[model samples]
Target: MLNIADTLHGWCRAARPFALATVVGTRGSAPLPVGTSVAVDEDGTAVGSISGGCVEGAVYELCRQVLHDRGAPQRAWFGYSDDDAFAVGLTCGGELDVLVQRVDPGTQPHLAAALDETVQGGPAAVAQVVDGPDELLGRTLCVLGDTDSAHGTLDGGPADRVVAAQAGALLRAGRTARVEVGGDADTCPERLSVLVHVHASRPRMLIFGAVDFAAALSQAGSFLGYRVTVCDARPVFATEARFPYADEVVVDWPHRYLERTEVDARTAVCVLTHDAKFDIPLLRLALGLPVGYVGAMGSRRTHDERLRLLTEAGVTEERLARLRSPIGLDLGARTPEETAISITAEIVAHTNRGTGLPLSHLSGPIHRDRALVS
Candidate 1:
């Protein structure tokens, strides 16, 4: 979840040369995903991580070599082997394919610009050729998230244009994907592997209550990479000083604010107001939207009453099914901070299509999405 692009942007502005190592591919239960990266300076100072803490030492050495060589990008693989899982192999019993390359503003100005855009909250993606001829190794194409065009050179030919188009498509879809280019008969015989690293803005969380629980949840949501907004009809409670973690604080009717705001499928709507007036109207509007998560906090009796009111107000049965009443997971939470944890946990599970079960009980990938990991 480290913002490597932000770090790289600062380094580029300072005219500091660095080596960038990225996890281009993984097998089994790797600790990090394909786009995870670490930037190392000449003094071996590192920013970001390719693994949680498992393979950082080895990757750091590889980065140092890249800085020393100042040549074509190098590809290396690390994993648990039958002979030495304790040595260079990953102890997590997973395999990682890493691409190590030198990055300097003088040579790769487009990369610096792309990282700058990402750090500035503008959507962007960096597509790098991880596997290709020696001349093509480390070649890059940066696709702007706001437009279809791209910057950077990948042979300055049709293949680069095609790669830029593909990267732009992935950026528009808000996804990070690995693609093979120049494999076709008409293009080139050698297949080129490319990894597109996408940087998109954080999702939004709209909390419609300024109570104690709201304050706690605001902090939790911010930690979970949510652009949180705390809204309430009462100006006394909905103050910026009260919810310091929230991105914005507004004193307005919950339903009215939501109706006027811009919400998409990635947005999460939480109704902490238990009052019938605020709860009914907001749920009616929220349940019908295409948001990712919608939850209302209340007791069982209050939930049933809200359902009845929503039904009386003509909320569809299909939309009512989307409502998650009682707000959070069944954690038996009693305190406001605990309740906030529960709520944000449920939001994460819902967004990732997770079962909300303990890791011991599940037998699947631990990291749902590389994008979500950030």
Candidate 2:
């Protein structure tokens, strides 16, 4: 699986035979998401996890069986059980459908190419037939979504084209899901059902400021799984040594850098440079883009002035509403690190549609089902 790309790549290159067990479906409070997986080598060595630990031991044996007997593309089900400690299931009140398949250089000629593309940090996806005809059970397809390039075939069947295109589309949008094709879902037992796992690069977090706050924010953003980039026109302040956590420290005008760089719906922009000259020009462009989050750090008076200027510069009221001025929650943070936490918390809340209210003040499920990411 793409999750353990390095280990898989190493096994593939060394011509090591292995079996891959993937979590393809889940219900209730699953500890891990759908694409979580574990790879077991010929020696019974495992590389990853599906359940936190509850189901790993059972799945480990499944992988070993797949390798020894080659009677695979096996599907196994595990569920929560409090009545029996010896039961091979999750203890976390969740159920999972796991599929284990054998992988080697011979049967899967694409074993190396798929791992290479993913390990190199390109946008790639792997689609495997989880439910379908016997012959199509372990059929897998690998796609480099951005380039419209693919590495494997899901059998030389007509269903191959369908899953390939869908896999590429999912990879481009950075989504993972189970899809059905080739037959009506209500009736046909032979209908092709594929589970796609995408390995897209980390989303970008553009922090436009070179202050100490930016350094702290860069660290916070990186810990939150963002590829942080710190940008400022001031070369001395924007040095990589200053913002150690930023993936890139750019010495360019903030507005100019944003215009030339790539940004998408998953990108987050933080305007920490409160100066009017840099703030106005850069924010005018960022507000119009299809980015995920846009926030600015400033006092109440600065926010009022910035709003008036952006309005005069023709940023509509609707677009202006998208900006989070006087950035972060009302955490009353007094230090740079604390402010970074406040800001990152707001970003997470916004992204996940979470109420800013403390959990103790509300009552319901602690976590909601996430929407299919794009």
Candidate 3:
């Protein structure tokens, strides 16, 4: 989805007027989600996208019309069935409801500030209803950062609060949920149909031990859209000059780094520092936490020795089981780059509950990765 705030920022900088088109609801296999947005400037330039090249042309024409009429923000719907429904229509046979709002030049600062705060605070969710009765239309509420407090509101009193609370809960789940509020549930003080959009931030993959393998693994992690961090106790190896593409390079002890940075189920930890002194403490620390993937590189003999050492160091057999001793899949990867791919594949498989079999020999959706789901 296009970042509406960026488009607005450009409009303000260029002193241009634009119309923002946002998806408010969907009935079937909609290409875009509720919060998907697009902006069209007075000069007919477009930033972002609303659909999968299905209704953009029609939306553009609507944008032009709104620009000419200087009309108030209004709700619009698009589908494939109507003969007059625009030449471009959804191929998936789904229907979409959208909101088209004219950018008010005066409110650029307020909108820009909100956008900046939201982006800086990381993945978050914001909900607004642009269509409907005068009493409930064009109302917006946003949960800034990772906190629960919201800015802006709908006119529906307790109903607005109910919707805001729902949005916050969805944001915490890191997934968008379709909710019907203001119905039989007394929780919704008023009766209204609302759509909730939750944007979850990317997960962090912090790779400890800046070795040759770390560089390759970092590249693989980037392909997976993880915020990759490469670290090592040795400054000489951990320098950015070595792994320039890494999101971050920390020249500190592995355990020390984990102590300062937050590591949760969404986080992954890799111990490539094969040395006993380095691997032992780092693995112990990582195993103690609820990190999604904790891997250390070693051979069968190496793993056995490491296990003995770890057991001596007070790590339990259950914790040792958590450590994917050999690391990566059974792909028999040899080179650094290939090994990195195998390692990343193993991580994806572990998270996705995969049997790690070739899909050509299996059935069902091959791309059943939860990372994609989230």
Which residue pairs come into collision in candidate 3? none
Q: For model 3, give the 10-residue run with minimal summed lDDT.
A: 365-374
The lDDT values for all models are: 0.85, 0.86, 0.74
Clashing pairs in 1: none
Instruction: State the lDDT at 111 in candidate 3.
Output: 47
Better of 1 and 2 by TM-score: 2
User: Which candidate model has the greater lDDT, 2 or 3?
Assistant: 2
Candidate 1 residue 137 C-alpha distance from true site, Å:
4.3
Query: Which 10-residue window of candidate 1 scores lowest in summed lDDT?
Result: 365-374
- For model 1, what is the alpha-carbon lDDT of residue 306? 92
TM-score of each: 0.84, 0.89, 0.72
Query: Per-residue error at 62 for model 3, in Å?
Result: 4.1
Off by over 4 Å in 3: 1-4, 12-18, 23-34, 62-87, 90-110, 118-124, 130-138, 159-186, 191-202, 222-225, 290-292, 300-325, 329-332, 346-374
- What is residue 186's positional error in candidate 1, in angstroms? 11
- Give me the runs in candidate 1 sitting further than 4 Å from their true place: 14-17, 41-46, 131-137, 153-193, 369-374
For residues 290-309, write the lDDT of model 3, one tens digit per residue. 88899989888888999898
Candidate 3 displacement at residue 368 in angstroms: 7.4
TM-score of predicted model 2? 0.89
Q: Write the residue-wise lDDT of candidate 1 on 293-360 in tens digits.
A: 89999999999999999999999999999998889998989999999999998988887688989999
Enumerate clash totals for all models, in the order shown.
0, 0, 0
